[model samples]
Target: MIQVLEVKTEKDIKEFIDFPFKIYKGDKNWVPPLKNDEKKMFSPHTNPELEFCDTQFWLAKDNGKTVGRIITMINHKYNEKVNKAYARFFKFESINVEGGEQLLLFAENWAREKRSTHIHGPLGFSNLDNQGLLIEGFEYLPSIASTYNKVFYKDIFDKLEYQKENDWIEFILYPEDCIDERILKLNETIKKRYNLIVNSFKKRKELQPFIPQVLEVLNQAFAELPYVIPFDEKTGSYYIEKYFSLLNPNLIKIITNKDGEAVAFIVGLPSLSRAMQKANGKLSPWGIYNIFRAINHPKVVDLALTAVLPQLQRQGVAAVLITELQKELIRYGVKEVETTGIFETNTQAVQTWKNFKHIQHKRRRCYVKEL
Candidate 1:
């Protein structure tokens, strides 16, 4: 028998977070998230996103042993904007198809009680959080920002009649192939024509002040993307604290126009998947050293996020950012680059990868079912 328990106490939440550790114990590709970091998302004080969303966590127990976990979330902004009571389920994990089914049913009932008409995800509060379940490239170690999961996991969603809502594709690139002389020249021309400037900093302090504007540009740039809830000041600050602070200054590229308004930006990090794997999700002295080592000497870097303002799309502004990125890659002696997922429907973003020698190695999807 499957017993679904609501996660109410701190101990129960800890058990919810630790369940994956049990399932992926012998799996080599699995990367455990830092415990403290995982806790912050469940805390309203730490994650400002909770202010605009309602969420519930549940764990499945079989014979009194925890077997699965899931989070049911309803973003008020998304529901209001779409004019539909759509709920999302993410942070999903299970040991078997039955366990997975029980977890999904728990989420569906919760959403139904809230008057939601549809349920979708393997999505989180926003795009910044991990979304999608890994449907391919099981052999490849996932980057810090991406997800990794057992291939059989999809069977549960299929059995539950969840139709594919969207798919995001990931690519692997040879940084050296990203540099094309013609594009470099084109970038120079675009910069001159548009009075655009590419800013590079050797220190994090220099990049701090521009964080707000960078996020504002991000909202403008990705406003049209599916399920993208624009970030307000509080949410923006929370993101900078969580993800941006860990970025190496040299790997960031920010492009601005004559008035110093950001038009494009790209953020990459030396891949720390391996380091985190070795640390088993703890970031103490040795783990911290491994992370620093990865930053200073990474063979594979992860292109985590990139965006260009809608008005500036297809204006060669992206080429300007890439040209600068190529220089940084070469300087770092990086061999390969793994890109974070880009929505398959986002043709503009997907097209940019075609310019380089790359392959779509991994694909993930969001599944949905009408209530």
Candidate 2:
């Protein structure tokens, strides 16, 4: 018989974090998240979002062996904003379809007890957190910001009658093929015509002050998107501490208008997928060394995040940012670029990728079932 247990003790939490490593063994395309980071995300003292979200973690076991794990969450803040009682399940994994079904049933019952009308996931505390199930591109190596799973996991969702709620597509671009001479020239013209100034950084200190404005632009730009909660000061500061150090200063581009206010920004990181794989989810001495080595010499760059002020959307700001960043990528001898998930319905963002020599190699989805 399969049994489900709520994760409450330190040992249980460790099992929850370690379950993926067991399932993805020998999977070259899977990247392990830092174990320390995973712990921090679940701690109330560390992750501010926990203050407003009710969450629980579970493990499914059969004959004393772990078979599956899942997390159920209800973000009260988000529920208030949208005025809907929607629950979410995330980091779901299982050894087989039966284990997966038991986990989902547990989550569905938990949601119903909480008075939620529907439950959807592979979502996290916020958009910045990894979300979506990899419905396609199982062979492609996932960026550190993306999620990966066994192909059979989709079968579990299908059997549970979960309907697709949304899909996000990822692309791979060759920097050389993506750069257009006309776009480069047009970037300059756009800068002059709009009195926009492009800022490139050589050091983190040079980029520090503008961080707040970048978050503002991100909040404004993504306000209308489903499941996006505006970043409060505490949440923004938490992310800055977590990810700012991994960024390559030279790959960051910020655009400002005549008033010197940040209107748009793009942040890219040297791909750490291989380094994280080497680390095996621990930041050991050797793991830290591998990460630094990757940072200094990267063959692939991940476009982690980009945002423009809502009023400035479609004014060629995105193109200018991309052009500037691409030039730097070439200078750094970068060979390939990987993009974070872009919603399939986001036509404006999708159109920007068309100018590049690219392929829609990966697709992830969020699934929902009405209670």
Candidate 3:
């Protein structure tokens, strides 16, 4: 006996947010997301995605115990531009194959009523949220804020005939050992010749102005990117506030051209795997302390986002940033650098990693089915 409940009320939503606790009761690697963050991301009153999108969440139950959950989302702004009523699903978890199928069927019919052409999953409310399904590296514990799922999740999707549409590749780097002498000299020469200054944010207050500048450049540089919806002012601020707290000084490199304008940026944070595992994504009286501690002295560093201005893309400036960062990474005794997920088709970005012997350590895929 399986049933899926649409999370519409406060209680239902709370259950939806807490389902993972019950589902992964004994799983050691699973980390709980903070209840407050989950609330904000799903609630129209809090999530900025509500400005241009709509989403619904469901929790699956059998015999009065939670078994699975899923979030169905539709970005009006994206569907219109992409020329299809494409739907996305996220926060998916399950203990049974039949239950997962039933939940997905509900979403399929819902999208059909809206005349959607395709359905994709495990993506969050928008690109700003988590996107992609774990297709490889299930044995490795994921970084904080990075996604993890049971290996069987892939088998279920395969059983559904969903077409693989996109792949996001993550890399693990041995920066200390891979820095070539030629590349090192080239990095120094480029920095001096171009008069580009790499700014390292020392104090929390110092990052305030650059927050908007980085976001502005990110929005501008990645405007034409696929599946990226433009961020409103509020959402932009929220992103900065959430990230700067865990930043390591050398992790952020603000690339300023000779004119002193921020032309490029890369943002990385100390991994909270241990802390997130402890806090379970909650910032409550008990959890907040653990999360704060994890960020201050993190073992794994997750490179969440990176971008270089389009005008300078042809000149190979991103390599310069990486080369310098790699040296600092060695001095810092960093274990391994996690490259942000890059679209498999992004050859130029891939090439930058090749110079440093970066391995495609993880593969997350997006699957679609025509409704």
Candidate 4:
């Protein structure tokens, strides 16, 4: 017999967070998340989104043995904007096909109650977190910042009648590889014409002067994106200070305009999968050591974010950004890069990597249904 239990208390919530650690226990490709960090999202006190969304987390069990988990979420903000009923299943899991279908059925009906037309997910409550499933790259080790799933996982979705709605790509670049001479010449020309420079932060202190400006640019650049709610000063500053502090300064390049404004740029952070896996997402004395060590010892650089102001778009700003970062990767002995999820509909961002020969190695989809 199987049963689905909704997350209602601390104990239930912990199971949802730690279940993955046990599921992929010996799998070398698995990267465990930070427990405290994971907990914050589900905690009513910590997850600010609860103010605007509703979520019901589920755990699947067979004869009282926990087997899988999923979250059925309705972002009111999403429904109100698109005028539809939709739900997302984040951290979906299952040991049996039957059990998994039950979880989906529950969420499907939840959407149906709102008179939804179709249901889609494996998405987070919002875009800031992981939002896709892995339809490819099972043969490679999943990075700290990317998603990984068993081939069977996709099969489960198919059996449940879930269809692919979008996909994105991750690429690898080597320092030894030379940028095409023509492109290099063009970048050189653009640089001289704009009086621009492509470079990374050499010290934390150096970024203090411009980090605020970078935040301003980010807000402006991303203002028109859907489902995006601009972060306030405190939250935005927290992200820059907390995240930028851990990044490999070498892998982050700030592209400036002739007037000294950072018009286009790329920011990459060191992957901490190994450390998080070791800590089980704890940060006690020893856990802190693993995290600190991961800073300088990151095996993969998470290409966290890239942005170009619309005024500078299609002007080779993207290419210049990548070229400078590639040089930095070579200097720091880095091997791989994982980018943030790109909208599947955003073809311009997809085709921007003309030099990389990207393999479309990852796929994440978002589904829509009418309310």
Model number with the top lDDT: 2
TM-score for each model: 0.97, 0.98, 0.92, 0.86
User: Sort by TM-score, best first: what order?
Assistant: 2, 1, 3, 4
Candidate 2 on 24-142: residue-level lDDT in tens? 88889999998988888778899998998999889999998999999899999899999999999999999988999999999999999999999999999999888999999998999
Give per-residue CA lDDT, model 3, range 286-369, as digits (tens): 676777675566556777777788877756678876766665566656777776667889888878767665677789888899
| Superposed model 1: Cα runs more than 4 Å off | none
Order of quality (lDDT): 2, 1, 3, 4
The digit string of per-residue lDDT tens for model 1 on 195-299 reads: 899989888898987888888889988888888989889988887887765678899989988998788898878898888887787889998888888877767
**Model 2 pairs in collision:** none
Residue 185 CA displacement from its true place in model 3, Å: 2.9
**Root-mean-square deviation of each candidate, in angstroms?**
1.3, 1.2, 2.1, 3.1
Score residue 278 of candidate 1 by CA lDDT.
76
Q: Please give the lDDT score at residue 289 for candidate 2.
A: 94
Clashing residue pairs in candidate 4 (N, C-alpha, C atoms within 3 angstroms): 84-371, 85-371, 117-370, 118-369
What are the per-residue Cα lDDT tens digits for candidate 4 across 1-371? 77888888898888888888777878887877778778777766666676666877889888888888888777777777667666666788776678777777777887777666667777776555666778767767656667876667776677766766666556553334456787788888878876787756777677776676677667667766655555555545535544565666766788876678787778877777777777766778887788778777666677777878777777778778877877766666766666666766777776666666555566655544333
Model 3 clash pairs are: 32-280, 33-281, 34-281, 34-282
Error of 4 at 103 (Å): 0.8
